[model samples]
Target: MREEHVQDELGRLLAPGRVDATAALELLIRQALAMGASDLTIEPRADRFEATVRRDGVIVPLAEGPRDALPNVVNRVKVLAGLLTYRHDLPQEGRIPADSFGADLDFRAAIYPTSYGDRVAIRIFNPSHKDYELPDLGLDDETRDRLSAAVSRPEGVVLLTGPAGSGKTTTIYALLRHMLRMDAERRARRNIITIEDPVETLLNGVTHTTINEAAGLDFARALRSLLRQDPNVLVVGEIRDHETARAAMAAGLSGHLVISTIHAGSACGVFSRLLEMGIEPYQITGAVTAVLAQRLPRRLCAACGGRGCDSCRSTGFDGRLLLAEFASMSSDLAEGIRAHMRLQDLQAIALRQGMVPLARQGQRAVEASLTTEQEVRRVLADA
Candidate 1:
């Protein structure tokens, strides 16, 4: 259909109420497709619905529309996603396709029923766009080289640690892509598997596993089962428990380059985190290889030429940069965590052992002033 016809159809499908259309939504969709968007949000209020698209570690508002008109928009989305009825009281998932800028777009839509009406969120995953390069993640040469080396190891553990909103998953995925393409001659036959409660990235080659919280498909059980299958490389989505920790340590020791992630601010913190989960100290020092802790910092968009403009919405930052904390096993931090030392003490010793702290990485962001002191302060705050 023509562009005007598509917009007309969408307008007609919407319920009768205040209608507001801006170029923002179009830009939002374009930006997300070009980069990668984890989720999309529509905030409904008394007067209007504010649409925000999260990209590059920041939330940018796309447009504002009449509140009464939102339900109609929600209805349209529901219909397009093939939902019989849409409820604003529970979580719902749906899929839809839309045409934009000459290309057909595929979107995975989810709606969560909220007090202020149904909040609509969408995660757009495109299978057709097969070309993904690790360097596209916007890593500098230094960080890129370090990350490449860490994941290329034959038999060791590399952990990506960060809080929930951090860029942990993105970093891990980059490393996984590296592994998927590491071999030059393409002669190596390797199996890459991931265990996630809800797998995010739709990778083609890797065998994806989902955990059944009730039926015992949890990480630990899954990891044990995975080992028996003799996976050449394994990825445990997150090390959330002692069993999973033990299993991952075992995977590392068995000469499989097990790449995993954790919910910690620093890489070295993984050792103490494992111990806190009840894994033995000796297991950590022997089996673990390196830890990668990271965060997503709001990045300045090169589009507006990094200058303040109405186009960029004046926040100056339009994208995100990855801030990482990599902890390699050292004679110091490894020995400290094994002895049940405080993370602070372990970090102090690890610093001397060449451990890279998040603060140090944050400082680089600060030096570029790509990030502010407040941003760094909030991120560096004690857990």
Candidate 2:
């Protein structure tokens, strides 16, 4: 459809009187996919309902409709997701299969009760998207090689650390796919199992499981059970709690190559985060292989020379590129962890051992004209 036609249709669907919620939602989803959005949020306001799509770590407004149309639209989404629409007093989450939308995409729907009304956020996943390969992740040669070496190990934990929406999950998935290809090339068959909250992608040779807290199945419990399944490689979605962290370490030490993601500010911060989780220092030194921290900075718009343009939504940026720092465990770094060294001391050790910092990578990107200094500063301000 043409741009003008799309705008007219959206206007009609969101008009004041009598709205077709189903058609309105379909348009929003189509628009989100077209914009390469990671999430679509429909929020309730006092006088109107607004829809926004998150594209490349930035949220942009998509549309707005009369407040009276929101409930019907929310109900339509709940029905599609197989959620309990009648219960608006509590939060609920469910999945909408790709086939339902006639697209190669997966939608995860989450609804929470708000003072104004129920707020809905839908995460869009394209299972067939192949842009997440290690070569295509925009990593420098040194960082990529270090990550490849770490994941090539037969036994150890490879952890990806970063804040939310920093592409940690994408990097981990790429690593897993690379491992699978390597195993195939070597004529080696390995059993790989993954425990994820929603099991985003469907890999052909991997066993994927999702966390079902309602069924008493969480990450910790699931990891403990999967250990007995004779998996050569285990992928825990995220190490959030003490039990899960310890379980992952045990799995790593027990000859299984464990891969996981954790929330940390930087590569060296992973150790401090694990220590704070109550994981023993010995386990940290023994089971961990490497920690790769990364961030997504918007790529400068080449077409407009960083000027506002229609191609870049007038944002002076087209998409995002990965900026990463990989910290491979060395004897000195291991000893520092064992000795309960301060975070700065450990970071210093990592730097001395040839580990690059995220700030330096950002500076490199800026110098290379891949991104703006302002963009890099905005992303790594906390790091």
Query: In angstroms, how far off is 109's CA in candidate 2?
Result: 0.6
Instruction: State the lDDT of candidate 2 residue by residue for 1-383, as single tens digits.
Output: 43456667877986777588889889889988888889999999998888898988988888777788889899999999999989889998989878766687889999999998999999998765544788888888888888898888889999998778888888878888898898999999789999998888878899999999998999999999998999999999999999999999999999999999998889999999999999999999999999998999999988896897888877899888888888988899999999999999999999998888999988998999989999998889778
Give the lowest summed-lDDT range of ten residues in model 1. Answer: 18-27
The deviation in Å at residue 117 for candidate 1 is 2.6
Off by over 4 Å in 2: 1-8, 128-131
TM-score of 2: 0.96
Residue 193 of model 1 has an lDDT of 87
lDDT (10s digit) by residue, model 1, range 32-51: 55545555687777676766
How far is 333's C-alpha from truth in model 2 (Å)?
0.7
- List of clashing residue pairs for candidate 2: none
The C-alpha RMSD in Å for every predicted model, in order, reads 5.0, 1.6
In model 1, where do residues sit more than 4 Å from their true spots? 1-38, 46-48, 79-88, 94-106, 126-146, 196-205, 209-218, 301-307, 368-383
